[model samples]
Target: MPYRKYSELAELVEMMSMAVTSGRFMNKLDDGTYYNLQDSYETFPVKKFENAKKSYAQGIEEDEELLFLFDITLFGSATDGMIITNKKIYFKDFLEDPECIDYVEIDKIIDRKISDEECEMTLCHKGKATKIKIPRFQFFDHHFIQFIAGYAEILQQNNHLLAQGKAVLKDGVDNITDIIFDAFWNGKKVEKIR
Candidate 1:
């Protein structure tokens, strides 16, 4: 839901950077990487809805928590290309189940091959088009954390740069009263106790 609202990928990056610097719910690891507290809370075994139906048919209670975990992982991978490889997750069970299958769809697109044109043109003239290959980006658990922490550290180191800019909106002119609020009022309800 949060990812859906972002207009561009760069905006999401900026928000993530802000979140890391704001210290809302991120933790710094020993290796100078930052770990999102939300990730740990949301982690669970991946399962498919059809597999859950089969489990129900087999007299096993449907595990909604497991399904939620699977969705989280899938969404995380799609948004960041980061695969969280933790042994505790029951990914094998999801794969082995006949009713459920992990989603893996790769789309191939054809682009103009400038290399052939370049070779032909270069044989006649000195000008030639260069072929460039772009590398794919991957974000693993360690790297993701490191990325967050690196940004956070950079923000801390460059506090003066941020302070130099004038604030468009001013803070409250007068003191504000404290207000009590339910912690989980605006948060997702935890389904399982374990």
Candidate 2:
């Protein structure tokens, strides 16, 4: 399966970093095109492998998953003020994992406007509301560096899902001709059933 070239991943990280730092949502416009506010700038660049490795070592020693995730999130926030946010898919395994426990600590950083009497807790985009505990912090630390590390790991593991065709770039365009032509020709030659 094809993976995103390192350059492409770098570009994506840069764009996300910029969006978070500027307090702008990276939403698609009604025209089906993507754009960001011009005034926005990246909080920080993603750390290189050497730096990540060093931090990972320290993180493992801390035996704190939230700290680890926080480290990852803050990777991008080092240059600018912390302004990162995290959104997990919310799965059983994720909740059970110690690392995930740390990840949930992100809620502490969000700034919710609701008061304790008005607050309601709901499951991942579903289920009935229930009374729940709220943490002291309202938002996750918007650390750009840590976010870079965590997101990069996710992308690396799931790169196969992004494959559209063989790895080839011609004249600055991703080449998908081989896969497309092969599929078209082979599709025509398949045997028909009565």
Candidate 3:
């Protein structure tokens, strides 16, 4: 995976850190492009990851158009073994454990925090708080880091809106109960904790 390349991941993370600290906000335009609204004065178009997993069900590849749409909707947010679509977040067992790949709806995420060293995500389901953390050194994946940073923005925005009593889309939540479930568990049949 590209993220396993530590130098590449480190470089990318460093760039992102700079981008964040530069006091410029990356605004996504309606035409699937992004531009810096503050100081950097940069503009770029969205790029799709050809190596993205085509599907959660083995042997089924994701369509290029669909993947492109996913990238545009999520602003090129993706990583090996993990994908954040408009409706849900899908993930595979990268640890080679005996668990099944699964997904969580986008509406389920509640809050999250992304720091330089780690990402702490908090999910609320059935009146319970589920937390998931990804440490930087242990899993040097670009997609994971990107997701943490990008989704952190959405999570914070949604959280702020909620505090103001506004309705917002589901953005970031730590709903993955077990990173490793039964291998036979398919992407379907995921249920909220009712």
Candidate with best lDDT: 3
Candidate 2 has a TM-score of 0.21
TM values, all candidates: 0.17, 0.21, 0.27
Candidate 1 colliding pairs: none
Residue 178, model 3: lDDT of 21
- Of the pair 1 and 3, which is ahead by TM-score? 3
Candidate 1 or 3, higher lDDT? 3
Please report the TM-score between candidate 1 and the true structure: 0.17
Off by over 4 Å in 1: 1-36, 39-142, 153-158, 165-194
Position 43, candidate 2: lDDT: 30
Between prediction 2 and prediction 3, which has the larger lDDT? 3
Supply candidate 1's per-residue lDDT for 146. Answer: 35
Displacement of residue 9 (Cα, Å) in model 2 is 2.1
lDDT of 2 at 41: 44
Please report, in order, the local distance difference test score of every candidate based on alpha carbons. 0.24, 0.26, 0.34
Residues 21-64 of candidate 1: C-alpha lDDT, one tens digit per residue: 34433333222222232344533323333443334223223321
